[model samples]
Target: MKVSSCLFNSLLLSAGVGLLAPLAQAGEASEEVKPAPLELDTAFVTATGGATDLKDAPASVSVITREEIERQPVYDLNTLLRRVPGVTGGFGPVGEQSKIKLRGLDDKYTLILVDGKRVGSSADLSYRRDLARQDLNWISPNMIERIEIVRGPMSSLYGSDAMGGVINIITRKVSRTWTGSASTHITVPKDSDRGQTTQYSANASGPLTESLGLRLGANVTRRAADEVEARRDAQGDFMYDDGAGGSKNQSVNALLDWQINEEQSLSFEAVHGVERSWASKKTFGDWGDTIGVSFGPSRLTRDSYILSHTGDWSFGTTKLDAYLNKYRNDLDMGKANSEEKIVEGSLNLPFELLVDQRLTLGGQWKREELTNTNTLGTVPVDYQGTPVSGSTLKGDYSAAFIEDELFLLDNLSLTLGNRFDHSDKYGNHNSPRAYVVYHPHPDWTVRGGVSKGFRAPSLKEGSAGAATESGGRGCGSLRPLGYLTGSCWMAGNPNLMPETSTNKEIGLSFDHDGWEAGLTYFHTDFTDKIEYGPLGQYQGRWWTMLENVDKARTRGWEGTARVPLGDSVTWRTNATYMLESRNLSTGEDLISSPKLSAFSALDWQINDRLSTELSAQHVGKQRGLGNDFVQSYTTYDLTANLALTKWLTLNGGVQNLMDKDLRDGSTNFYVPGRAFFAGATTYF
Candidate 1:
């Protein structure tokens, strides 16, 4: 069938199926509805790589609920991340390539996990780093149940990449006996330079029996071609511009959970997705396809599996709990790819030593193996029109850790944790953390903490190959340096050292009545920071190299507030400000980090059937690695949701309402402009 025809059919089928399933089940006796009690505490998992009440956990944590995700009308992961206190978006020019920053650290310093397992490649490079973080574009907003963000060193619990923080993406799970919904959205650009996007998604979850549950979801997204006018320089040459580009994506996910016995449970999940797009860079009187020039037509696919078991037993007054998990990941990136496997287990014991005091102990172990392959160029073809000169890379890592939490008094608590890891690439290392929490009153809480963390080198850091003149054909004259250079070049390093960091933080949280607020201050020091040097004059051509640099520091403050104006109205605002400086022989501000960032939203519930929200976001100016300053930018968004009936809802929003013309200094690219979107969700 024709692609367009298939899409239409799929939409209709999904909508019909989703609406009908719930209605059919509605005929049965309704189950008891128990509204969860409202609480001011945050929810998180990264601090321990397991679900832990944020109020009791030893680290600084934050949670963005599903309601918050819809309040700001955010569609991509970057949009959601901007709301995070100390985190900042990265230097990539395109949406798919954007990175995340934590405590002023790059993507490699922060770890991202889905369902508590790492799945992608997170090689920290200077030009374009590969992060294991899932691409938000492939995930529909409706698929997320909630997001848990823990800030600060957590390597003791989650291992490498948890040097600065962790982001755990929890997808929608089956919660009710039977549920299903479908939604459709369209984004309309405000100007000719911007393009339009249309998306459709369907999700369903229910119990096959009292002991088994299942969930299935799918989404398809499309973007119409659009062009951005070039910005010209004094000599009539285009300084920067993104030409016409378009993209299409499709994805599907399935999950199953089973209760094998009273003491054990098992769950399985799978996801598949594909994306295609054409991008370009444009200059006055010069236009070229970005593919192969900037990068090429890229394709990526991933497969993952997880198995876990949990059990509990009591030994007198001491209680023991243990869990074991096995995971696997397979990634394909056209000319380059990787496969990884890991097995991990943990044990925990919590006991009361005295009436008002308690002790907690924990230990964990993990084993991992990775295999990778990469070709030299866009076309791996050789002298005889056949692919040649590829490399195979492999490695392993292992770690163990222990932690303790002690309640010194009814209002005070202390926590201590340590971890040791040994890797074939980096030998051995250890990390330690300590924290104290004091509650002077029922409405106020104070916390202080310090920690050390480290990140090991990735496969690309050591085995990446270079286009040397002696080893390859047509590589002799390829030079990537200076203005008249031959293009771009990349080379690897084998002697690179692991990056290490030390962090200190203090914070206060208070809530009473219908108002809540929090503030935190943090400082971080980094050593042996990986530096990807810019293209330089090498053999008369521009060449790039990866190297480890000296010390760097970042200090920042974050503040948040939420107040209820009335029974049906609320106001929420959050702001993050940071001072980042790096002294790599040359003193300068870090690249890609905004000195000030903020997000605020006001929501109103017009009765139970209608609601509206307004939000604003700001990003401060930043300096590039080259010391060039980029202008700051701000944007406003508006959204409205209406419950037309018990089973039908409509949502509409407009983003970048100011039509701001924003450019990033690091990547020298302009972001998307003002756009409007509307969607309808129906449930039987």
Candidate 2:
């Protein structure tokens, strides 16, 4: 199989060279082939942010285009994010609550930005699990023009929650002409007992004038009921049967842009979404409906709005930019809910000191708030007769940061940055970072950086309530023996410290002829890591707390190559390898991190009218907190697209074509197997 794969790759490269040879020769004869358009090779951002070629950026960054998203048949952001190296998606009971992790870091460390603005749930909540932030499912991938991921701390530029890195989601903007499109998809599950999913989406955008533009879009999705197999006990034996569940969700968004002259611009956007789910298990108690289990339905509704304005001015030879953003999110969950509001602003000045030399300075500020309530019903009484009730909590945070970039030469650059944050709950923290990039030749570029990042304690870590045990008097109790033996957990700590880390990284990129590839390595040493543990004498129940553990490091490498197979075909392949471990004072390997994983894909353009794709992914085995574990698995997917006409196109795909049953290590949830989907899109 390895030999065959190599041979196929060679053939593709040869065919690509052969196809491009004639074009190159013709261009040389007529002087038609000039340097590639700057826009095609560089990434563009708003005036307030720095813009440079992807290769010129002094960070490990990746950009996924709209065409790539379509080719991969991704239904949402989570699925598309899987393609990014050193990133992982967690599975949850409800699909809407899923979270993403980068470089083996938790979700709280990664900041998610939309159109360069922070827009999501606040971390000031009593339930850590419920503070997973924005639901990517609500954001329509169809409206995305491009996505840029910076794989390291950016708090100096973006402010809080940027410890692991930042993901900038750039939406499509109205250009010169008006255009609209619509698409629908129907997905069927491998299990005959499970129901199917149907998704529909539409978008339109246009310029009202040369300086004004508007865009509107919406998406709706319904997933059929699916069963989660029984969970395994300590001995890896199946326990009680977990029934099936289903979900329905819909969202809409609108955006307006006014280019007020050439140096100033203003934009406004609003989004609203609602999700509903029905499951067979109770959230907090033990009850029975069919097999003596209570069946309850869950519903979530969210409304969000953002307004931003930016200005640019030229002072002598220096370019100055300033911007402000206001964001709000309101969420309603059947029993409880929360509201979050944030105001942020920033200013940046970049100037060139001499030939091949440049400098940049920037600063930013942000404020956030979160309010939550616990609506879980009363706990059941045991033989010992214990009672518990739900509660509510609220929190707020504020932060500021500054950064600078200096270019020593055409081939070398250095960056230094710092951030300071003050939280009502976690007090204050200061973080600093430094970066360097060197290019020895036209085809080789090397980069290295080190930074100190931190995450403030969440509201959940300060004031969340605890649950009591029944002294082992109930046979169906889920609590441990120690808990049932007379121990009960208390509330959280009011003086918890922030989680801090020293992150270090090095990377290299090469692009020559028809080949391009990149490799990056990173290590993070964490202090005051937060974990769910017993607080002092509170033996049984778990409390969200912090500890100063030893070094925890995640090292990874990613490589990708794209070779055109003749004029109408291209073969692109990428692979990722990651090794994550922790050196405790006791020297023990950390559990739950997937030691090795990989994904690959091949694209074949049969003709201008049709194309086919095949991809495969592999996940390694993982050890849990105790003796329990998860096994390794591999899955395959196939897809095809046919252009029925210039205005109409058909697309279909089958995921898990091998029908493999798999479960994630982080959330311990089962993934659907052998799902098939078909859709048709129309362009006008």
Candidate 3:
């Protein structure tokens, strides 16, 4: 979790109950259908970021159902996202440092959410990640209902990290019928030296009363490390891989809902999660010195609390949500430590503005604070070079927005939205979005939109000493997400401005006779791109400061398809190809970014008690995080499920079937060859 000291100023935690839009009617599935297949024609709430039909939204959206989650050979959120077209995850410089890039955009550009509110820190520059991201590892897969993704600018709807897109992890809901399930899995690498991973979880949901319901879930996971023989150093001595630094995480969550009335509802939720990892863990010893040098043992803890109320009465529906989140990241090196806290609230109202049109109005207020200290850290000094102590920093943000969806015809509609945001340090700015969706036929549709997005300067960038903060291998450039690794630091730029970009997209989809396909093309122009260093003679290196000195353009194509093979087999695939990701300011190729990525799966059902699936993925080369000459890799996976009885089922899979050597030089992330796992699920 610790990336850099900037993580204290840049990283943040966000929590909210989320603004849930009202639904027109209840949806019921036929019990006779038994176990139905994945639905591609279903509705989703993340495209427009509200309760809207997927076919009616004017943005490119994809959904991963609970069923799919149960079937995929993945453990974390970033890995799950790679299966989505136009998205890819960095292999890593550090195991936990891996991030998602959408349409060749950096992780900082994408936003992640839990329920309806944001997850992880809003900003984390580095220094052991005082405010590290609320990683998916915190949530139990058994507690999820579904995951929705929007692959395009959505700043007008959700502000900030929406420039690239949004990934919303929706938790399971309270069920009307008493229901619960328990599941566990174990994974073993082809090479025993690589160690193993074991995970388990249980969840339950049902009605406590005619108008009251509750849901509870919990999970525990542990990963063993490895002691592989790495390339030798110049001395000809074999180097040791840091894979020995293993990790453990656990979480407990609860949700209580009260249907106060047919038109009103109240809910309260709580989530507690903690994680521990060590860089010095050794394979031969209980706790080895695998870390070698620098960074040391580390741990991060996070907690979230939320309360929400929604009502649908009179002429419109209204929603109010409040949340508080706290995080602590600690590194034994220099006794580095970072603690962050965030409190937020928002109100939303959706009302009919015309006979066939609806308007949504909303406002939000939030505050972020961070405190961090390291014995080896530098404080801003006086003009006389006297070091001053500054271990705490904070900032406030406020915003108001409006969205109008107007129907021009029964089959044609336009969505227009605008938002204005004010930050104590960066001042105020406005963002706008426009989209038109037209359905020429029930089976065919077209959609397109233009939008603007921006990212506010972090408190570290606006308040740190101009020259006192320094360290890291990437000190020479404004690194993208995960910029700092070693001792890298930068001189603060108080006058720094927010980063900005404009995006345009066009897309079409077709569905008929169990055939579904979609294609989208996008182009984005970025300005005021933020990074460190504008080459200078100062200290014989680039001046490290947050400056608006970069510009660039990117274009790409994304496509997805699903076809039913007979009545028992199905095939699905998604792919993305980026044509360019250039740095106009430096006229150089960009850093780690997705170029060509594709995912395909085939599912077969053998009778009513047995089923199997095969999947493959191919990822093209990408620039190293800060180095030159990145690499490309491909992997395959196989999985199977068998119903032992009405309430019990067996599941298993083999990941990295080809055992392809997967690793990114810039990021410490690596694939330890092929692995196999098996587990069982039981219902009650």
Candidate 4:
């Protein structure tokens, strides 16, 4: 099905953002000193192989600096995402199923990383391919110094899951003096069983000794399960019992930086994160003439651990960086349990020389293994949640890569890169990318790039395991209000080929004064997409199988504008418009991804001691899961900061200030209502 007219929404969004453009034109008030220059030329690492200015980066990128993070009242990744353009955050049918979508793509396509290291995938391994409801809850906001989001394919620099984009979180730096801060915040909802959510965090960074530096941090969050408010089925024919959303998570990270010599240095880091959440679904059952409703729990437990060492050495014009990391994760979902372990090591040497050019050579090796248990946990919460029975899956790969940057002219630069990887599961594959940047004027930069990206088949997708789920709404055998048992099966496809895509994009940006604006258009053509079979009947029962199928095309346009109206007032806005997203094979539209999304933030610095911000997010309508349409909506939020003293500060905010009713048509995700929060922070 074709979605709403993109032209109309694009115009509407552009008009809304256009208002902020004139704010930059507001005449400079007498005696109002010129604001500092915008950070358009700020250095970032994730978009490029190394540090580069934002305007020099090959792909589209956005950054949330520490100052911005501190100003917002966000406590979790999901909430933090809403502050960015094209990303959406809200409730799901089951509170635990809520997620963040990037450019109309779900979390599965968007990879998550901390300090340039990949995190474990939250997609269920055994069966159903269901994603973790809280994909970003494990990250500690207090530990982050900045977050860099790169849009479009980046599989050449990173690997896998970069099909949509990459979110790289950079942690804080250590200081010479003993320093730390503590803060706590709570949110009170207007209504719904979800109740209240609270969070606490503490962090310290300083010198442990003359030659040693250390940073320690910890965070804990608790979200009371929201009680289901509606009982009627979509058809309003029968009553069903559903589940609640109760989540609790805690994490800690430590880092030790040591100085061996002026030319060489080494660091050791460790991170431990854990999360526990529960989700439930109520389905109607009919025994002969009588109709009944039954509910079951889908409990999940996830823990992640990382230990690594990083070393850097410089000899004259040559530099070398080496890293060794061990990553491990464990998951327990109802009757299914899985554990994954990965060991990866790499070396990056940029000592090679070419024809008036610099060449960077890199080599990496990685080993990964997954173990799936057939039985449920000691106490099974859902009988049907068992998947993969019992099996061990393993994959190994090694690769070598090189990137060369050549200056064709004083104002033009060209970059070319390629990597060859051999995988035990999918044999050998190669990825290549080319990018160029031209500066016609000091304040203007033009860039365009194209590349091939791929996502290797996971061990679970190649094993003999399968996940089994047996309940769904609106089964053909039953009416809209009645429940019919329909089972979902996604057995492994050992012969599956790695999913690959051809990604291309180009853009231009203007950065001058205290204002910056940019527009980028991207298109990705994907082949051999790994997807599940349509819901159908097998052996007199309903089921679906995992298979590599379909060709998809996703193309979109993104625009961002930022202007510091004055020292006291600033305006920022970002708008995203997806021209098209569809599955070519079946000719079906990608329904769950919104076609238009936008975010606008207005900041007021009343004084050094007082500041306030108003943020608004708009999400266009789209087809919800098994639905024709979900309505579009807008949300307005207000937040403020008050400095009580030199080292003490207070914060308060109202989320959903308008209290506009919200319900996602795709998954019956209903908003809990307006919320109020207050918090305090102190530093030593």
Candidate 5:
């Protein structure tokens, strides 16, 4: 099957591998057992810039706690998040290239954070390729405390890149006492030709002195390439390219905290990470004949330094942060580097108006610099009769925001917020949001919100000197253009406009003695969608340019439920149903997005030392590259954990119990047939 550019192809071809993690042992038996409470009361920090009950957060939120993480057999962040409502993963040939989508929006619209700080996007620096490895797996699961996921537009508080939502990973805190853990996980597919994966991790946190503390963590992971010998399909196309590629990754982080006084603290942190990926594919001619075979390898390294301070006064809490981050991408042909520096601060003040009110004020300043190999040369000058030359580009932005949380009634609360941002490149933009939360009954909660969000053009997308080759692949149009055949040029448009969206949602949830259920309906109107397409030709050469020429509408319903069957058994499920996800300008449906997706799991506690879980994931029919539909499929997994001793635990599982590979369909994504995994953890 023919596809568009490499980026488009990579976006369509993702893996649905089921990686498992071990769970905690069952609790002791008790007579007249009462069902446990759901996540309604969990402390959530991402939704409102401060800690609040999950049920009270203004936005649709989900939390994955440490206990939940320990009980599952998940090794990667994508696998851990695929079960959440309105969340999906699309990975490239390299399984580690996890591209997450929230509410039918791609990675570019979803803001990723570590401890509520942006992790700067490396994917924005490249064109026609997927370099978004920085999004997921940057931190080891062993060092994580919990994850907070807020879905829908959040620009009113977070500014840009939050049109779809935000995902904040909260790491474990430094303990007063010495504590640490070491773990190893391995996955081996039933088909030897497929890839095999393994990972090792360790973490330690403790007090260094009466007024100081330290925390450290490290992890390493490696995977072998599938179909290393390179296989071809009946049409003489390289099937090996469809197989999961190989990857190697490493990460280390350290943090030190000093208590300045009873009401103040200072902290410093450093993190370093590396990612390597390699694969091979065959070149094809216009006549569908093999031309040559080539191997591609790339590396990415990131380093970050952060200094922060927090102070608690009589009426408010103050926080300040200064951070610097650096990234380098080394491709087989060229190299690119980027640096980001940011200074941000926020204050939360509580007071009594007629009722009660909590006011939050924040401001931020950020600068980004990018230098790449491809932009080092001058433009051809044939297109516009003028040559453009640039090797480095820099951009800066400043933003300020204010929010007020008011309790007007005994059971009702309202939140109003707005943010203003000014950038040298994009001028001035404003985002506004309003939300309400009400407790109709003691066991029920009703919430709704409306928000506006936007995304400014990246440096690589707005620079006339920036250019990328399509590698002879056609544009979005199916029928090939003569001038677009064989190494077409895709240039940047400095006049491009920003993408914007208006989002609305309402949700109702009920939680009573572990019998929990929730349903949320959301709608989004996305305008000025940026796309790379034909501009104008000169000297018989076609030049594609990024332009704001499209609009899209996405509406969906997300539902979640939890039930306690007995004292030792529980069942949980979540599902998403898309009502519409269409590009209004092109009249084409969003590709690779399932209309209905659901995940369910059943957990049983057999004894004090053992626990078992049976899980299933269902992906409904989805639009394909052409006017076709990829059939729906479901995968099952069974995992069990055993506590060998007080400090040692062992677990094993079988993924894809049915081995229902979609090879019969036209789906380009890879689905590993069947896999088995085993793991062990040691705690002190």
Candidate 6:
């Protein structure tokens, strides 16, 4: 796809207005006194592997501050991400089944991290594949210091699973003085039968000794399931379709940081979380007739242990990290589990040869194991042609990367990086990236980058022993093949290639006296996309298998603005407009991704003790399976906060204030109606 002149002209016009409006206001404020130089936030660390200014970061980055997290109630990460540009949720009943998407790509393409450590997804081990939600909410919101979202490919530094983008959640650090807070919140929907939620959380951080500090946090949440009207089946039995699912979540995390010396530090951390989810679903026959109903709870648990060390030497800085993660899911059929062990290290050196530069070197080793009874137990054999008896699928990979940032001129900088990865199953691959940042004026910045990234096939997608069965309607083919009268099998293939993409992005922004605005354009050429389809007939049963036979392209524009309405109020907004997102072979739109989405919020500090916020989200029409398209909709929320005393705070809100009905006839997506919530926090 090509960029049109009309779209380019519009962007130029919008950016010109945004850049001039702030300067015009500043010119009229003062003539004798000049404003201070523009200073941007520099605590962002995800995009560049270390603390870097948001304006200087080579990639498109955004940060969610702790203040934003506290302004309104949020239990899950997806709800919070709705405010960010270039993000969307997978199509499914709300809850454990919905996944997070970036840049019109699937959830598996995005990487989730905690304090620079990986958080493995449960879907990788389950037979349902990408249908499961990512394990993103393991850490309570109260324990988070900030979240960094980097859009576009990042494989040059982070390796695989970063082809789409990366989200890094930074947790609170240990404080010198002992401090703690406890809070509880309850939300009730207009409909009494469903959508009720309750949560309790607490956190504390303090000094444990002269050189050591400790931090701990825990939370519990439970939500009642949404009730869907039942229907009578052919056999006169009551059956239920998909509805918003209910979930119970509990988590605890602890960290101990030791100041080995003024120049060095050591840290150890542990996190454990459990989730139970239940939903009523109807089973269908080959002819799309309701056959039976299934209702039960599935349990998922995760545990992580991490050890890290950092040293600041006279010449440079060095860091090392090692972590172990385990995830397990228990269902009626059986239990599926996975484990990951990783060791990583990095070194930074600042020196001058021909020009001033900073160099970074890093390497990582990872091993993964998965045991799924649901997919592996169907047959009496294994992938290695060995008899099945407690057999487990395992894979390992190693990677090395290098990056250099060069100060070419007083107002210009360039960054070049490359990464080499060797996988046990897919052999070797290389990713490279180049970026440049320029400052024409102190208040204006221009940045652009182009990079290549790849996503290796998951263990479940590469295991020949893994298989799933569905009725005729679920079968896939390369051509116009007639539907089968019986069930067919979709098996995994061991000889699939990795998916790759070339990502390019350019952005321009202006900032002055807290008036900020920016615009970015991004495009990606994706090839060798892995998908499931028919691979001819096998033993007369008909078969579908994973293959690399698809190509796609995605392009879009993103814009953001923040303006102070007055001394007591502020308005913020961000929006995304899609130019193209299509599967080249079939010329169809990507599923569940909106063409135009936007979020806006207004915050008012009425007084020293009271504050309120009004927010709205608009999602544009989206294409679905075949020729179907989901209609567009908008929702609004209102929330307020009151500081009762020095040690007490109260908060409440009305979500979906407009009472928008998100249901369309199909059960692909769901969102609850108007709801009220209240909470209180006590500090010590």
Q: Which candidate is the best by TM-score?
A: 5
Residue 540, model 6: lDDT of 52
Ranking of candidates on lDDT, top first: 6, 5, 3, 4, 1, 2
Across 1-684, the per-residue lDDT of candidate 1 in tens digits comes to 012444444444433342333345545554422223122234565675334566666778878787766543344567777677777773223532256777767666777776566655423211234323334444666777777888887877776788879888777766546777787776666655555678788887888998898988888876655555455644555544344356566778787878777666677777776665555433334464332122222344545555555555462122122222221222244234445566666655666776333333443444433333333332243222333355545567777777666778888878778888887778888888888988899788899899998888776665445322222212223334324423444555667888888989999988899799999998888888875555444444344555786678888898889999989889988888885545544477776677898888888865555577888888788764344566677888777766556677666767787877644223344566776666677774
- lDDT by residue (tens digit), candidate 6, 150-232: 99999999999999899999887787788878888776675443457788999988888999999999999887666555434
Candidate 3 structure quality by residue, lDDT tens digits, 475-512: 65544533434444456666788888898999999989
RMSD of candidate 5 to true structure, Å: 6.6
Error of 6 at 291 (Å): 12
Worst 10 residues of 6 by lDDT: 30-39
In model 1, the worst 10-residue window by lDDT is 316-325
Cα-lDDT of candidate 2:
0.59
Go through the candidates in order and give each one's C-alpha lDDT: 0.62, 0.59, 0.68, 0.63, 0.76, 0.78
In candidate 4, which residue pairs get closer than 3 Å at backbone N, Cα or C atoms, i.e. clash? 193-226, 193-227, 194-226, 194-227, 225-245, 335-376, 374-389, 624-666, 625-666
**Model 1: CA > 4 A from native:** 1-43, 72-74, 90-97, 122-138, 240-244, 280-297, 315-334, 354-390, 464-484, 487-489, 533-544, 663-667
Estimated TM-score for each candidate: 0.82, 0.80, 0.85, 0.83, 0.90, 0.88
Candidate 5: residue 332 Cα off by (Å): 3.2
Question: What RMSD does each model have against the real structure?
Answer: 7.3, 8.5, 9.2, 8.7, 6.6, 9.7
Q: Candidate 5 at residue 148, lDDT?
A: 88
lDDT tens per residue, model 4, 1-684: 111345334433432332242244346342323222122324787865556677777777788877777765555766666557656544432422256666666567778877777666545432334434534655567677788888777777766777777888887767677878887777666544444677898988888788888988888887666544444445654433343456677778788887666655567766666666554223334422221221112334445555555455562222233333222234343234344454444444444344345455665666665554531122122123333234456677777776776767767878788778788778888888999989999888898899887888776666534434534532432333233455334345567888888878888888898788888888889889877654454444454445788788888888888899977798999888888878888776675666787889899976555567899878777666554565777888787766555566667777788987644223354554676666766777
lDDT: worst 10-residue window of model 5: 11-20
Better of 3 and 4 by TM-score: 3
At residue 194, candidate 1 shows an lDDT of: 56
Model 3: CA > 4 A from native = 1-42, 90-97, 122-134, 232-244, 280-297, 333-355, 375-377, 380-387, 466-472, 477-488, 534-543, 662-669
